[model samples]
Target: MDDTDTHLLRLLQHNADTSHAELGRQVGLSATGVHKRLRRLREDGVIKRTAIVLDRAKLGLDLMCFLKVNFKNNLASPNLDELHGAVSALPEVLECYTLTGTNDAIVKVAVRDHVALREFLQRFSEAQSIIERVETCIVLEEIREGNDYAVPKPQ
Candidate 1:
């Protein structure tokens, strides 16, 4: 909303565990003021939800891949809801997005290994009958992965 609010959000983005007092100290607000502002931000939908970021490799999920999917049926005639539901039901799929190119959708997936990846792909193929082709690119290294977004400055 204001400069102080923007600053608070930036601090929280870096570390959601920041105490109200610490946030207040950095933003020059009282502890109660900081708490109230944070509550207001949450109520106003400025802050969606807080979550913990995990290390995929540490969790034994060593494979990360991007899948480009194309449909056999005419794009205008396909059952979009059923297709979306099928993709959403897969646990290995981390994210999926609609595209404007030759492919219909791009999906980010994570699995334990190549064997698991094959099984996941097999299930993916079975999930939708309209699938024409799927191209996969495995990630060798992830330099950065985060949900951070640029916070606009108050005018």
Candidate 2:
């Protein structure tokens, strides 16, 4: 992508609600040109689906914990797809990943309280055969946030 594309991404990241006209002005392109560029970006898979990020506390997810899990056997020995499906189905599991080394999967779990988290942990430990052990750390605060692009400084 060119500098124009990077600028576009930054604008969208800051506020996806930006209008096509405003984007054209900011990116030094006409409205039609901006539209065509956006279409090309989408077709090339550069732009994913636009979504709204909700506040976890406001959404009733008061607790957030990061979990590391180890598998009983080789990476592919257990059904990875099935494990992913099962974990994704749980409302509390926000994110899960397959990794290298001692651990198999890392998960982000969100719940209401310590009691509820412990209950979910017990259930998860009992049901999944591939999961050998799990270690969790609670999120105390957000240190850095994600940004889709970087804004240029004034000359």
Candidate 3:
């Protein structure tokens, strides 16, 4: 991607709701040009679906935790895909990452509170057929939108 594409991505990442005129001004393109590029970006999958950032706490997800999961076997093993698929299907399981460490996979999960977390943990733990073990860290704060101005500052 060239500078314009990079700039577009940074801008969209901050606020997908930005008007084409506003996006054009920041990137030094005409609105029509910006619109075309944005379309192409979406068609080519350079840009995924635009989304809004929701307030997690307000949505009843008062807790944010990262779960480091250790599987009983390696992903390359023939039977491991079924096990991983099961883990991924759990709605509470958010982002899942295959890792290179003592842990086999990492996931992000959010819940209402400690009690709910404990309940979910117990259920997952008891499912000895798929999960091996998990470690979780409660997030206190996060910087999700700091790259806001990394693109051309909205003009």
- On residues 1-155, what C-alpha lDDT tens digit does candidate 2 reach at each position? 77787788788888888888999999999888888888988999988778877788898788899888877774774558657766866888878888887778888888999998998898777667777788988889877755455555434
Instruction: Please rank every candidate by TM-score, starting with the best.
Output: 1, 2, 3
Angstrom error of the Cα, residue 23, model 2: value is 1.5
Clashes of each: 0, 0, 0
lDDT of 3 by residue, 1-155 (tens): 56888888887887889999999999999999899998998899877676677777898988888888776665656426754665566677667677896877777887899998998777666653556677888888886623244544334
Expressed as tens digits, the lDDT of each residue in 6-116 for candidate 1 is 999999999999999999999999999999999999999999999988889899999999999887763645646656888789989899877787888888999999999
Q: lDDT per prediction?
A: 0.89, 0.81, 0.75
Kindly report which residue stretches of model 1 are placed more than 4 angstroms away from their true locations once superposed: 73-78
lDDT of 1 at 113: 99
Clashing pairs in 3: none
C-alpha lDDT of candidate 1 relative to the true structure: 0.89
lDDT of 1 at 96: 88
- The CA lDDT at 33 in model 2 is 80
RMSD each, Å: 1.7, 3.6, 4.1
- Models 1 onward score TM values of 0.91, 0.86, 0.81
Q: In candidate 1, how many Å is residue 67 off?
A: 0.6
Better of 1 and 3 by lDDT: 1
